[model samples]
Target: MSKAHELLKKYWGYDSFRYPQEEIIASVLDGKDTLALLPTGGGKSLCFQIPALVNEGICLVISPLVALMKDQVDNLMKRDIKAIALTGGIHADEVITLLDNCVYGNYKFLYVSPERLQQDWVLEKIKNLPLNLIAIDEAHCISQWGHDFRPSYTKINLLKPLFPNVPMIALTASATLDVKKDIIKQLEMQQPKLFQISFARENIGYFVYETEDKGYKIEQILKKNPEPSIIYVRNRKMCHDLSFQLSQLGFQTTFYHGGLPKREKEKNMHLWMSEKAQVIVATNAFGMGIDKPNVRTVIHVQLPENLENYYQESGRAGRNGEKSFAVLLHHPSDTVSAQSQFIHSLPDKEFLKTVYNKLCNYFQIAYGEGIDEQFSFNLNHFCSQYQFPVIKTYNSLTFLDRQGIITFSQEYSEKIVLQFLLESKEVIRYISLNPQDEEVILAVLRNYSGIYDMPTAINLSLISRKSNQPEAVIEATLLRLKEKGIIEYTAKNNDSSITFNEVREDERTINRVSKYLEAQNELKQNKLQAVLDYVTDKAHCKNSLILNYFGERGTADCGNCSYCISKKVTKSNSEKDSNVLLKLIKEKPLSSRELQQITKISEEQLIFALQELLDNDFIKVLPNNKYTIN
Candidate 1:
C-alpha cells in the first residue's frame, strides 16, 4: 500500500479514500498547491490530513471557526495524533508553549484562525517552525463574493511570501465559480490542481412545504420519521420554544444556541449525540463539525437567508450515504420576514459610523487610541443605552468587523474560574462541616490544581464524572461553597466581545469600504431572491435549481425530490381526468361551465383534457363556447 493509504488506515481506520479524496491527497503529496471543492460531509479534512501525515513536517491549518478547530484537534488527539489549536481564549504563555511544542516537540498539526495570521508575533513564531504544508479551511471566506466573507482571511496572502517553498491546499464545502476563482487569486496558488466533487447528494430527498400550521406539520413529520433529527430555527428563543413544543408532543428533544453556557451546550449536544434525545432544535450555530452520521432528517422551520446556507445545512443529513430528508417549512410571511430582517435591516453607512463612534465612546476610547484593546460587549445594554435597534446595531458591528476595522467574536467557549478564599485548613473544616458538598469540592480540587492560590478554570463535567453526580448537583455545591465564603466561583460568561484593530478614526474611515458594503448588500438581495425563487417555483427540479445556483449545469431531475414526485402524481391524475371527461361527454352533450360543475377535477386539468379531446376529435366546441361530444 502507498504511504497515504497506510497512514489513513493506521490513523483514520479507513480502508480507502472517498472519490477525489485520494486524488487530492496524491496532488498534495506531490507538492502541488491544490484547491478542493467538496460538499459538506464529504471528508474534506482527510484530503489534507492524510497528506500531512505522509509528509515530514508539521501542517499549519488556517481555519475560520474556533469550534471547528477544537473539534478537529480533539478528534485527532483521540487517534493518538499530536494536534493543537491556538484560538482566542488561550493565554499568551500557553500559546508560547503550544508554539514551542509545534516547533520542537514534533506536533503534527497546528490549527490557528485567520485573524491570528495578522499578528506579527505569531507570524515571527510561524517563520521558525518546520512547516511542511499550509491548509486553509473554509477557503471561500477569502472571497468577498462568498456568503460568509471575512476580511481577516484576506491577510492569508501574507503567508505566501513567508512560506514560498511550501505547498498550500485550500478547501471549502460550498463555493461558486466566482468564489473559487477569487480564492485561487487571493491565495496566489502556483499552478494549483483543482478538484471538485459533484455537490449532488443522491441519498437526500429535498422537500419544501408551504404550510400555515408549521407546528402541526413538524409534529407530523417527526411522527412519521421518528429518527435522529435536527430542526433549525432562526433565533435562540425559537429554538427553545420549538423544542418545548416538540417535547409537549412527547419527543425527546433538546435545544442549542451560541448564547448558552459552555457546560449546558456540551450537555445538550452530548444528549443528542448519545441518542438520548431524538431531536435537537438549534440555530445555525450548532453544527459546524458535528460528525453524527445517523441524522435522518434536517428540517428548517424558517427560510435561510441564502441558498448557500440552506444547502450546507441540509447537507448535514445523510452522511452515512443512507436515505434521508431535508425538508423546508416556509410560509409566505417567512419570505417577507427573511428579506426584511436580513436585507432591509442592514444598517446604512451613516448608521454604521454612528454605531462605531458610540462603540468607541462606550469603551471610553479617545481618537488615536484603543488599538488592540479588547472589551466585553453587552448587546442589550449597549442598545438600551444608545436607543439603537438591537438587530441593526448587531449587523453594523458585524459589517465593521468584516471591513477589518475591528474583530468581533461571539462564539468562543466560556471558561469558569474558581479561587478559594479560605486557607487549606479552613477549607477542609468547611467541607467537613458540609459533607453533602464534599464530593464536588474534593472532585474540583482533585481535577483542577492551583484553585486556592489563583483563579483557575474548573471543569464541571469532569467534576461531575469524578464525583459520580449530575452536573446540576456539582454546580449547586459550588454555589453553596461560594455563598459560605469558602471559595470565589466565577461562572462562565458567553457574551460577545470586540477588539479594535486600529485606532479610532473619523466617519470617513468607516466609509472606506462603503462601496464594498453596498455591493455585499446587493449580493445578499440577489441571494434572497434566489431562495424565494427556489421555494416558490414548483415546476423545476429542486436539485437542478440548487446545482444551477452553484454554477453546476445540466443536472438531471432527482427522481425523489418533492417536485419530481408531484409531477409523477400529476401525470397519473391527468390521464384519469381525460378518461373521466370522455365518460361524462358520452352520457350527454355539456357546456364548458356545465362540464366544470359536473367534473370532479380542477379547472386547469379540465382544460388540459378538453384540449387533448379536441385535438383527437373526441369532443367539439360550439359557437357559444360550449363543449359537446362528437
Candidate 2:
C-alpha cells in the first residue's frame, strides 16, 4: 500500500479512498497545486489532512469559518494528531505563545482564519514554520461572484512567495466555473490540477410538493419516512414553532438557531445527533460543522434563496449510502416572501453611503482618522438613534465588512459589573430590610470575592441560577439596590463590535468597491431567479435541473425525482386505473364511492381515471352520478 492509503487506514479506519479521493491525494503528494470542487459531503478535509501526515512538516490551512476550523481541529486532535486553530478572541500574548508552540511543538496541522493573514506579525511567524502544504477551505470566497465572498481571502496568495516549494490546495463545496477561474487567478495556483466531483447524489431523491396546507403535507411526509430528519426554515421563530408542532404530533423533535445560547444549542444538537430527537427544525446556521450520515430527510418549508445553498443543505442527507429524500414544500406565497426577505433587504449604494456616514458619526471618528480603533457596537441602538431600518442597515454593515472596510465581530457577550458603595454592615441592614432582594444580594456577595473592595464583573446567569431568581428579576432587584445607594451597578449591553481597518473616507471608500458590489448584487438576483425557476418548473426533472445549473450536461432524467414520478403516474398509472374502473362498472353499475371502495386506490386517482373513461365515451354518468357502460 502507498503511504497515503496506509495513513488513511491508520487514522480514518477506511480500507480505501472514496471516488476521486485517491487521485486528489496523489496529485497533492506529487507536489502539485490542486483545486478540489467536491460537494458538501465529499470528505474535502482528508485530501490535505493525509498529505500533511505523510509529509514531514505542518500543513497550513486558511479557512473563513471559525466554527468549521474548530471542528476540524477537534476531530484531528481526537486521533492524537497535534493540531491548533487560531480562532478570534485570543489575546495577543496567547497568540504569540500558540504560534511559538506551532513552531516548536511539532504540530502537524495549523488552521488560521483569512483575517489573521492580514496581520504582519502573524505572517512573519508563519514564515518561520516548516510548511508541507497550504490548503484554503471555502476557496470560493476569493471570487466576487461567489455567494459568500470575503475580501480577506484575496490576501491568501501572500503566502505563496514565502513557501515557494510547498504545494497549495484550494477546496470548496459549491463554486461555479466563473468562481473557479477567479479562485485560480486570485490564489495564483500554477497549472493547478483540478478535481471536480459531479454535483450529483444518485441515491438521494429530489422532491417538491406544491401545497397551501404545508403542515398537513409535512405530517404526511414525516409519517411515511419516519427516520432521522431535518426541517429547514427561514428564521428562528419558525424553528421553534415547527419543532413544537412536530413534537405535539408525536415525533421526538428539537430546534436550533444562532440566537440560541451555547449550552442550549449543544444540548439540542446532541439530542438530534444521538437520535433521541428524530427531527431538528433549524435555520441555515445549524449545518456548518454537522456531519450526520443517517439524515433520512431534509425538508425545506420555505423557498431557499439560491440553488447553491439548497443543494448543499439538501446534500446533507443519505451520507450513509442509504436511500433518502430531499423535499421542498412550496406555496405560491414563498416567492413573494423570498423577494421581501432576501432581495428587498439588500442595501443599495446610497443606503451604503448613508450607513457608512452614520457609523463614522456614531463612533465620533473624524475624517481620515479612526484607523485601528475598535468600539463596542450595539446594532439596535445605532439603528434606533439614526432612525435607519434594521435589516437594510445590517446588510450594509455586512457589505462593508466583506469589502474589508471594517472588521465586524458579531460574537455576543454581556457584561455586568458591580461594587458596594456602603459598608458591609450597612449593606446587610439594607438587604435584611428588603427581604425580597436578600437572596440575590447574598448570591452575588458569596460568588464574587472582592465585590466590597472594587467593581468586579459578574455572570448574570450564574447569579440567577444561584439565587433561584429569573435574570430579569435579578436585574430589577439590583436596580432597586442601586437606587437606594447600597451598591453601584453598570451593565454594558452590546451584541457586536467593529474595528476600523481604514481611515474615514466615507464616499470614496464606498466608490472604490462599488463595481464589485454591483456585480455581487446582480449575481445574487440571478441566483434567486434560478431558484424561483427551479421550484416553479414542472416540466423538467429536479435532479437534472440541479446538475445543469452546476455546469454538468448530458444528464438523463432521474426516474426518482418528483417530475419523473409524476410523469410515470400520469402516463401509465392512469391507464391501469381506468381499466380497473371500467371492469368494475361493467360488472355492476356502481356509485363513485363504491367504485373507490372496491378499487382501494386514492380518491384523486379514482377521480382522474373516471374522468378519462368519461372523456373516451367508455362509461356514462347516471342521474345519480353512478358509472355505467356506455
Error of 2 at 296 (Å): 1.0
What is the per-residue lDDT of model 1 for residues 523-574, given as tens digits with 9 covering 90 to 100?
Answer: 8888889999999887888889999999989999999887776665466777
| Top-scoring candidate (TM-score) | 1
lDDT of 2: 0.85
C-alpha RMSD (angstroms) for model 2? 9.4
True-structure RMSD, every candidate: 8.1, 9.4
lDDT of each: 0.83, 0.85
Residue-level lDDT of model 2, residues 339-380, one tens digit each, is 887788898888899999999999999999986676778888
